[model samples]
Target: METQLSAARVSIRKGKAKPFWYGHPLVFSGAIQKVDGSPEAGECVDVLDQNGNRIGWGVFNPHSDYRVRLLCLAEENAPDYAIQDLVKRRLEEAVLVRRSLGLPSDETNAYRLFNSEGDRLSGLTIDCFGDVLVVASSALWVEKYRAEIEAAMRDVIKPRVIVWRQVNAPLRQDGVSEIIQTISEETVTVRELGVNYQVALGAGQKTGFYFDQRENRALIRSLAHGRSVLDVCCYTGGFALNAARGGATNVVAVDSSAPAIENAKANAALNGIEDVEFICADAIEAMQGAEGANLVVLDPPKLARTERDLHRAIPYYRELNKAALECLGTGGLLFTCSCSAAVSVDLFLEMLRDAAHDAHRRISLLKITRAAADHPLVPAFPEGDYLKCFLVAVA
Candidate 1:
């Protein structure tokens, strides 16, 4: 058994503190110091303090103004350890959580195992598509434990393949070389709600298909039958295709990205279905010209990058919703969503209400949706709960 730290001795001071004697392999703490000997962001250092005194650890951003994001208080005489243990433990916990949710490992091959800080594993993300695993290491700690993480996946999960899509450019600023590796196979297919999706292991957005919207798409399918559906910002036509399968009379899918439109068309073709229209244009313009659509689905991408961007984004959301409402027939359904973490669900709901008023239309909120079960949220981390979907009926 590893010896646990007794208690931490922490004090706020300026300057580097020397390590005290301790009966532990590792003692670490981050210090706040500037480049020119001025007080700046703190530095994380192994505690060489005497007598095994507990040391504090935190996140330190050297470039930005704020320097230390203290994660945990240090304890005295804590065992010195490698980051490999941390990564392994986090993955185990994530796996256990998914198992508790009754998620079949074989049914839907694509899912997220670890959501960076959300999983208490900082700077690392793991996405599983069937037997293939894609890993993105964004932090130095995760980079150090990469091999251990891969080994853990092999021993525990036994994934057929693993790929490392390292973000090296930003790490270069910190003097870290990015490592891209194909640890396993080069391709994999994922099943989402009974639909088969073939994605390149090394390519595609984030982790290929967006599994976060799995449940929401199912909900849209249930409501889209016998309706004229319009899917704005329809990347790859997940919603549009599902709506078509749901027996929609006709579906119009629009996106600004040409490649996305092509992929949507391809996805439609893959399903061997017709009676769907693909438009490569701005979502707002597409919504403006949309007519005779009883159901308008607006699953726009994140518009507000930060809190400061929200003020500018609210008007855009309002305008977009207003345009959709303008073409929505009476008693029509409007499935809208805002994936921006900066935009709170309350604020988004209010924006839609205001947009309806601006368009001189009355709308009733039918239901609200969030990310699927696979994307678990930690109570301490509100950022993990970013997805918000609203099903409204325009009266």
Candidate 2:
């Protein structure tokens, strides 16, 4: 741990400590009354109430609307609140939680090791693809403490390669690190539930794979026996391969990305599962052409990037889902999902209802699922629960 230093302090606006008190990790700019000292961007700052009472410690960012990301409350705080110590403890805790669930077992070697706010390391997410660790950081504090973070991860997981990536950086140059780029290599083959996949750590979407859907893929396997599955937006075919492994009569996987379709085919070959038809086409158009699949899964990318995008996104979701529901045979099953944190379950449910009505289909909700155990959620942070899956029986 680093030596204790007298850090800068920021006072919360009068009566604005309620959310922080309730365990919400974010403090918006509007909630801050004044800064007691001049702190550099991504500097550790002590959070104080209007009355000068210590509230907690947090990372401060002047540029972002979310000005402070709370690290730990004073009551439950650690003895040494150093960046390295905090990161190591949090990483170790996350690993232990996953180990408790028996993840990275004989059947699986890929999973989320650390989920940003969910693991209390706000704006930092790390995923494991076998020996490769893919990191995505939104917090500038991570850049300053990058060496510490890597060291802690090495102590816990000895990953062969660590690729650093950024999401939504203000500047393109700021998004990437030259040192990390020089050290990191590209692709690695990983397994999940006995399924083989080739993951591109530096190039692939959101840490190369969606390990959060591991349990959901198992659910697809359970329900796919003897059915013809249609997997729309099947990036590298996570669900389609599971369906094939589960003895689906036939599996048709479609994705707009040519590379993804090619990778899906390679994964099928790697798994020695030959009953899949990989198609590179727009998911909406492909869903429109579906031929009465007994099982249909619609897992698209984040359609609504922010709350402001809901108007445009809702209609897109409705249309895509309507097409999928229309292609489902009577008594078929549908595993539909939306990964947009901006989109709430209530709003998604409403859109699904409208889609079913448009498709002239009767739907019975069978199960509501979310991300796998590795991506744990903070009860106070609704944004932490980004994945929403609806397993329904359609007629």
Candidate 3:
């Protein structure tokens, strides 16, 4: 049965094989020359070059623009492939990668375990917060192999609870079923570099916390000491609480969501840090009226969900950075970030440049950071590197 399922062959157009050979994992719809077998969505299929030589094996999605997400590259002398075996191997590899990074280290108990395409598992993302594992499925195929995937994860991390969330992804949603494992506690207190944060898996943003910002937040310890820090759009106070713990004399956390601000305050108090102030207001408006902060962090929600929104997103990114820049004191540090996959790093930097010019401020790019080690980037898939952090010094 497995062999028959994996035997479906797809041929690529004459010049389109270049990307597949060059290590790009996605085979676009238009690149396909022909499909020898009529494969349904989420089926494993063999991808061949124009010459009919097997190039790779991937998960096929007829409805998605990315027609195939290549899971295994063909070895020069080897010609065998199995979807189940590949999945088991990839899941173990992902766990080993995180273990190599010393993740869940002494101070941190939350991090990404599987980064979808980054982990060679293109359909789903799994994150670990303390003892709970949050599984976010975006591809319909993931649901097809839910049991195997969960078993594989259990073989590795063995988390106490696994919460499933089917993100309203752009991919086909047919034949997908929810997987839920009950636990008494829906919320877990996760520790990141000594800062304790209560992550509500039952309700909150992606995976209950932005574990990608761990390293960047850790950097605040050295830069925020004695500085008046302002964390704009501070969801659950990740940065603000860390800044306070880092010995910042005063920290102000602002978010549009009252619940988020409340969570921020609770997180601050959880650590017994009193110098931080929580404010519920539109981050842009708050920053526009705010000033004198020695350190400002502008980590907003994704501005553009798709390429069509790129032009509209650019202006919003510019305006937000401009407002935040105005709030920064001379010689202050600005930790600007964007999670918009549609917004490239260069474009974000350009947005920063325009914002600096408009604010009449001189901004020095001190460092460029990215998602924590756990959210590994696949060189061939630029979209995997979605989180961008720019640490700049404003004067």
Candidate 4:
């Protein structure tokens, strides 16, 4: 008689092998055997070595190329833990880390509570904006723990509303349905660096606003006082709004996305700020035509999707940076950034150097910035790290 488990059994194939690998137990093989001991797919299972010791546990998807995505590795016969327990423990740990950093104060209620793999929570991320929490799920396990995650958010931080964003492309590839569910209130107000932002949890870009750039925006504002500033790809006018509020004489924001331009205008209005101008145009074109601006910001979207896309994306960055350099006045500031994980910090700096050379100007590095404290990066996993900003002065 064969041992029984709830997961399906998938045939393991090796290179040019005819006989299927058998009697090999995996903690999560996505392979389930029937009462008669047959194979099936898309089930969760535990994998074990030939010695009958548990190796790892994961969800199995035979239809997709990946047979198993391990969630955990634990010894066999361990007490079965509910998904809720896992979510609660992770949330508590995240909260503890933030408190240690002295975040979540009266002035700034917006910060990242969980950053998916960064926080060791695997496929779940939660961003808190004032009284609202935006949740993005990228794996089936996270979807399974949805209710528990929401409960933890309420019990731990007591946010006014929790918005669920299940439309991530990776989740759909895993055969998971996408649905935006509002777990609590409809509106939430969050303050960041003394600026109050009104966010509608039901409808907004990834988690309502761009919390990752919170620190960078504040830094730009500090340096932009009395300067003529230009913000490229200024989503929701984060940098632009901050520049104007920081006493910049003039601030112009540009983006190709119409919706983004609209949102930037609305954000400016929300702050009762009128010194900034929003332009719905390609940033590259805007940079080429921009003149008399001493401070230029070039924050393009992720141009490189993967390692294969890097070669092509490098030229685009070089061109954009070169254009910004050409537009900047003498002794002007250039704040440029790349949010591509494939683009390393060293490579990004080299590209900027190359751009400066091509534009016939020398630049002195002012400061280097990364994602805010909320978006922590694990040393072992570089993929969790993205968002690199460079502050330079054209000479």
Q: Please list the residue runs of candidate 2 whose C-alpha ends up more than 4 Å from where it truly belongs after superposition.
A: 1-3, 169-184
TM-score for all models, in order of appearance: 0.79, 0.95, 0.93, 0.82
Q: What is candidate 4's local distance difference test score?
A: 0.73
Clashes of each: 20, 0, 0, 17
lDDT of 2: 0.85
lDDT of 4 by residue, 178-257 (tens): 54554444766668877777666666566777788989999998998899999999977889988998899999999999
When sorted by TM-score, best at the front, the candidate numbers are 2, 3, 4, 1
Error of 3 at 116 (Å): 0.9
Q: Candidate 3: worst 10 consecutive residues by lDDT?
A: 175-184
- Give the Cα RMSD of candidate 1: 6.5
Q: Estimate the TM-score for candidate 1.
A: 0.79
How many residue-pair clashes does candidate 3 contain? Answer: 0
lDDT of all predictions, in order shown? 0.70, 0.85, 0.83, 0.73
Candidate 2, residue 275: the lDDT equals 86
Between prediction 3 and prediction 4, the one with superior TM-score is 3
lDDT of 2 by residue, 1-395 (tens): 57676779989999999778767888888999999888877778899888998878988787677788888778866753588878888898998999998977888988998998899888889998888888887676777678988988888889887888766542232332333332345878888999989877777677778888999999999988999999999998999999998989999999999999998999999988888999999988898887869899999999987899999999999999899898886799889999998988899999999999999999989899999999998887876888999988886
lDDT of 1 by residue, 1-395 (tens): 22232322233234344321111111223442222222322233332223333344433434432233333335522223434444566678899987886655554667787776566654577888777788876655456556767887787779877888765643453335545653434755566766666666665566566778989999988988899999999887889888988999989999999988887787777778678899999988888778799999998878896799998999999999999899887889999998888999899989998999999999999999998888876564576678999999987
lDDT rank order: 2, 3, 4, 1
